[model samples]
Target: MCEWVNRIEYSLWTQHCDEGRRFGHMTKNISECMNSILKGVRNFPVCSLVKATYGRDNSEFTVAETTLTDSFSLGSYRVSLASQTCDCGYFQALHFPCPHALACCAYSWLTWEPYVHQLYRLNSVFSVYRMGFTPPISEGFWPPYDGPTVIPVPNKRRAREGRPTSTRIRTNMDEADPNRPKRCGLCRQPGHTRRSCPQLRGAEHTRGHD
Candidate 1:
């Protein structure tokens, strides 16, 4: 009887036990929640983006928990933070407080706007065009130099018989910048960068005049 009991316990442990069961897949769970939120929200055009140029208030905020209200309305779908957002699709996509988040704000009085921003809306995502600049006017005008000196076009070498004429070669122009100034990011000075700064290197003797 004891031997039979031991065998049964060993079989259960070996066959049924799993390490993954003990440790939950948090990443998968979060991804699934995001997917659910996306599916529920209605779609919006990407070009209909709002210009959020100026920075938001940097004041520190306290987080508040909001309870779901009965019979909440979110466009087509009912409101559910448990579902992570409403059917309107505002809460999840922007990651900032939407109308539903505002409702949550009213109930909790905990500043749902901050939560909407902190959890979902990343500043980095919006920063893509923050430092955007117009392309500089090219010094090389159209209808390039009609100079007198007749520079003959170099003739291509004849391809070997039965060999392909096409060949792929990498160019250094990718790394080379014509307009990029040879200046340092630190101290906004010219010549060596901050990384190679003598001042930073503690070599006072090597520090040159401004």
Candidate 2:
């Protein structure tokens, strides 16, 4: 029965599965393979892991963010640095610049593209499951499996009983100011005519003043 199971497993692996082929549509399997590569790295020191992961040879150099021009083929939308995203789903979901944005940045000679991982990648998620494993203990440790002297923490300072006075400071106002009149929606300036606003109407003298 064990031999039969082994044969079956081998056969399954050798045979092509439709779903497995479909999984490669957007490189989903590649991400899963990367996750497996990172599995053993969880127990290692973080600085060491970073140095290893983003090492000179292994690093995937990316392009920088820059203004989109008619000359560049950026598809439908532009790269918005303020939002840290491109119009396509790439930068918004990943918090990393999309290929177009990266290309723009590279062309512009910007280096911010290298640090995008700090903004988006969740390193803590990998630590959670990796920390669950216990290290192998030395023999002759006995049933307690202990070595170091555990000390009861000494209280250095007494805990404060009362809350700070700043916490009790209260204000009478229940809502924001209501008298603040809406600014000219056109120019976004206060006390201005909407149609006459220079921004929306474009800068010009009234009727005939050159």
Candidate 3:
């Protein structure tokens, strides 16, 4: 067991050390992260909030000169406002400005809205529901069916059994290895299960002996 455990790093086993360094929080979950991102916008209307939040200042971030005009340096990270990307990788993956990108936006006196994907915008969402779907026609006005009807064979019908079997598609995961030994539940021994265990049968027969 110790040899098996030694094969993997200790950071993977416990989240204590890695969680703080990676996410800046020891116990932060998805819900908390979302709440932090949309903090003040909850009280306002969706469209109004989007506009209002975009106009808000990010004056906390201090501007610093980098090698390139479009890029900004944040310690180990490189944020490019023109390309809409950051060295941390969250900008491209989440289709929005990451911490580094947002910092660069603040430094450049630019709004973060342009860096966000169109799919998340209120106008794109409103456009989707603009076209009204026509209501489905009633079954009474349907055309008559001239095609041959399907008929089930009487012999093909399944007979009543103790329990109805599942019709779900089977996969490779369902197959058990033939080499594995079956163990007895009561005795914790191999070869037979608890139902056919000799010790259990003897115990049942000698119930009044004690």
**Top candidate by TM-score:** 3
lDDT (10s digit) by residue, model 3, range 18-98: 754543444447677546656877777899667654544232222323324677778899888777788899998899999
Report every candidate's CA lDDT.
0.53, 0.59, 0.75
How many angstroms is residue 119 displaced in model 1 relative to the true structure, after the best TM-score fit?
10
Pairs of residues clashing in candidate 1: 81-84
Clashing pairs in 3: none
Query: Which structure among the candidates has the greatest lDDT?
Result: 3
Better of 1 and 2 by lDDT: 2
Give me the displacement of residue 161 in model 1, in angstroms.
Answer: 45
TM-score to native of every candidate shown: 0.25, 0.25, 0.35
Structural RMSD, model 3? 31.4
The clash numbers for all candidates, in the given order, read: 1, 2, 0
Q: Candidate 2 lDDT, tens digit per residue, 36-87?
A: 5566675789886676567532433322112333233456767655566677
Candidate numbers, best lDDT first, in rank order: 3, 2, 1
Q: Write the per-residue lDDT of candidate 1 for residues 47-101, one digit (tens) a residue.
A: 3211111111111111212343323454556665554566678767776656765
